[model samples]
Target: MMRSILQVPAEVLSELHATCKLTPYELKLIGELCEILEPFEEATDKCQGDQVVTASYVTACVQGLSHAIAHIRETYKSKFVVTKQSSLGKCLAKFEDMECFQMAATLDPRFKLNS
Candidate 1:
């Protein structure tokens, strides 16, 4: 929805309502949010499919999510830097101690040899 809103022209937004126009900062923030949340969205979609989702698949997804988040943190320097750090920290903390997930990821054929 935010992406859809961002696609609307500034003139159209202003024409719709004086207060409807987003500031440059807000637009940038929204863009950052969309980029940051994309991996999570992809993971969610993959997990929600009709096919079976095993622990190995879920572990791989989580590992992918971690890598993507780390890349985003290292690559982007914006007003949301703190937000990025917070998210990375939370993700690590939540999954760091999950030995089962680690084992599953190591056993998964796709990730078995992955470094």
Candidate 2:
């Protein structure tokens, strides 16, 4: 089921999140995803068979998804712009920010974020 959720076409999901109402199933899916997957998959892939959990793993996973979803949204932006924010936007933005922060923190101290 988790894989299925991940399989949801980034385009379709972005559209639904933007304009359509969220069915109970979609809402539950997102909630279950964060609870079950996001924290570990994105931030830390290498456990060394030692560390139980790391924010880095979760962040990495989320960042990957963000790019996919955001790309989908951007590609169809003019065709399907949401007038107001949706719950999914908030959630996706959370991942986006984490990705940004992770990138910022990793670079040399002199580097600055572009946006």
Candidate 3:
């Protein structure tokens, strides 16, 4: 939705309403936010299915999300995004500490067994 708004011309936005115009900084922030949330959205999509998703798959998804978020934190210039990424990392950290997820991921042939 934010992406769609970003695509609209300033003239169109202004025509829609006086307050509809987004400043350059707001547009940049929205773009950064979209980039930050993309990995989470992909993970959610991967989890949704008629077939059951195993713990190993979920564990892998969490790991992927962590890596993506970490990359964003390191590379992104936005302080707000980096701060939010830190919060997201903290949320995901709990799953990493779970024995079940750890064991399942270790047992899954697709994932490297961590000694």
Candidate 4:
């Protein structure tokens, strides 16, 4: 939808500028969010695929997302500390509390004790 809107003639964008406009800060935030979520999205896709997905992947994916979120928070906290409770934070909050995922991953041979 955003792509289609952007592809529309400049005149149309100008006409709907009030509703469609995005400030530089907003665009930066959006990019940051996309970067932070990319790993989670890929993990979700892997889990959803027809191929067998070991339960071990759950812990790795969650850890990866946690790291990514932490990186984002650390990198941007100075500028956007107030948005710390954004979607990324919420996701971490929900999953980080679940300790069973780590055990499951550890039990799976694919992950083994190394995980």
Question: Against the true structure, what is each candidate's TM-score?
Answer: 0.65, 0.27, 0.70, 0.51
Count clashing residue pairs in model 3.
0
Give candidate 3's error at residue 66 in angstroms.
Answer: 1.7
Better of 1 and 4 by TM-score: 1
lDDT tens readout by residue for model 1, 26-62: 9888887888888878977765667654555666666
Off by over 4 Å in 1: 18-20, 78-115
Who is ahead in TM-score, 3 or 4?
3
Q: Give each model's whole-structure lDDT.
A: 0.72, 0.49, 0.79, 0.60
Candidate 4, position 67, lDDT: 72
Output the number of the TM-score-best candidate: 3
lDDT of 2 at 84: 14
lDDT, residue 33, model 3: 81
* 10 residues in a row with least lDDT, candidate 1: 52-61
Model 3 is weakest, by summed lDDT over 10 consecutive residues, at: 47-56
lDDT per residue, candidate 3, 79-108, as tens digits?
Answer: 876776777678776887789888877887
Q: Over the stretch 27-110, how does candidate 2's per-residue lDDT look in tens digits?
A: 675655454444335433532235433343444445555454455455345332232123346664575466554664456344
lDDT of 4 by residue, 1-115 (tens): 3334434665665567495586557556666666555666787875566667545576576667667667766766644443533655665555545667666666677764642
Alpha carbon lDDT at 52, candidate 1: 58
